[model samples]
Target: MTKNFNDLVADLSEIEGGYAGHVPPEWLQGRTAYGGLSAGLALAAAQKAMPDLPPLRSAQVAFVGPIAGDIRIAVDPIRRGRTASFIGSDISFEKDGEWPMGLRTTFVCMGERESSIDHVSHDYPDVPPPDIGKATSRGQALSFLQHFEFADIKGNPNQGPADYLRWIRVAERDGLDPMVELMLIGDALPPAAMKLVEGFGPISSITWIANVLTTTPETDDGWWLLRSRSDYARHGASSQVMSVWNTRGEQVLTGMQGVALFL
Candidate 1:
């Protein structure tokens, strides 16, 4: 049976186990699964296999191959411990006499482990939200953003180079597990933003890694502020640091992404 975009998104957000897949629309311009879709599916599979664990605090996914249409995903439970569980999965497209594109992900569950903290120091950007009139649909901004909602804070639109504040969160999915929601939100920041800072140029990420801070938000309702900045670009490589916070003014998670420039 064919499924609508909403239904597929709903399935991805759910807590149930088993394969979760989506057929990208022609408009997406990809014959295979979107990168974010694969990442979210891998996260969901990991979550479903370890439902008793705490919320997923971190996930590092490597896009080893391209996922064609009609993808099939399988989950493997690595370890389930008292305070945390480790899980991983592979997403492959089904085809006759062909290899499928795949991705592998590891999820870490948060627990009550104690730790010592050092001094805290990080400056938050001060910028007003983009006028609602200028707000654009995710489809208007980027093909993948179509599945998400974004509110630009810095209102910087120069394609040459820029950095802006924004609020991002996914539309609700029925039976959506909070962990899946968090993972989707965690993966939404685009690498294109880094290009803005490094001057216009073609860039591709060979691998993306996100480390979830221990103090991530506990709820999904609030608008999380994402402060993204480009720190370095050289030798056909670039990197960006992203800091996420809940609407209540609390630090959630900080992410760093490394990019490989094609040009």
Candidate 2:
């Protein structure tokens, strides 16, 4: 069954002092929920816990273990200030008669305020339109990929430059919240390291951090730009920088990820 993007967000349940949710296999990346889905759900839980906080400023998450089955998300308010707040969230699950932390995240939220400094260090990349690029099928085998479409602006993933740019968005959840959609689209690109390897094996994102620069609402167009570049790859790990741009050429999010490679 095809699951709506908003439906996944709705699955999260508010509980005493925390949140709870179940991840069906349709959203599974391997034996666990997709990395982005897990992070998004955790963020949703954080939002429920701290409703008055401003837009998301930044989120740092460590994928400590696999997230599977019924999971409990616990959120703690680290500190609350006038313009900003720091919140901590964790995903816990029971397996083999023991419960363990599968993921840990710290989210920073900042409210609107007057600021004298306003500038952007970088501009959106110039790339061909999605129609001119090839649609990526490498991700087709993954169940979660069904929720969205990916078009690679660069050539073949294995033969292209170390950099990649793509146009991606949810196929059905057109009205989805921008921040929630960013979580799903942030990791849409295949690891840039895959271009350096001979063939596909396996790569797992160990840690991910996303910084939100703007909180504009989603537009009717629904497409978001995803650009990723590898910084370095060695010792069975790869690090990369990522950014998400809206159709209006606004840089909505910037992120960094560290991935474990088994290729």
Best lDDT among the predictions, by candidate number: 2
Model 2 clashing residue pairs (backbone):
none
Question: Per-residue CA lDDT of candidate 2, range 1-263, in tens?
Answer: 55665776677787877977777777788776788888888888887777776788889989999888788899999999887789998998778878699999998888567789988876677554465234533245447787776766654443335677778877776555567777777877778888786777778889999998875545435678888888888899999998888777778899899999887
10 residues in a row with least lDDT, candidate 2: 132-141
Candidates' RMSD to native: 4.5, 3.0
Tell me the tens digit of each residue's lDDT in model 1 across 123-241.
Answer: 55544433444663354433555666678654445322535467776544445555565555665655645535545545554455665665345544535667656677678777777
Task: Tally clashing residue pairs in candidate 1.
Answer: 3
**What value does the lDDT take at residue 57 in candidate 1?**
75
| Alpha-carbon lDDT, every model | 0.59, 0.78
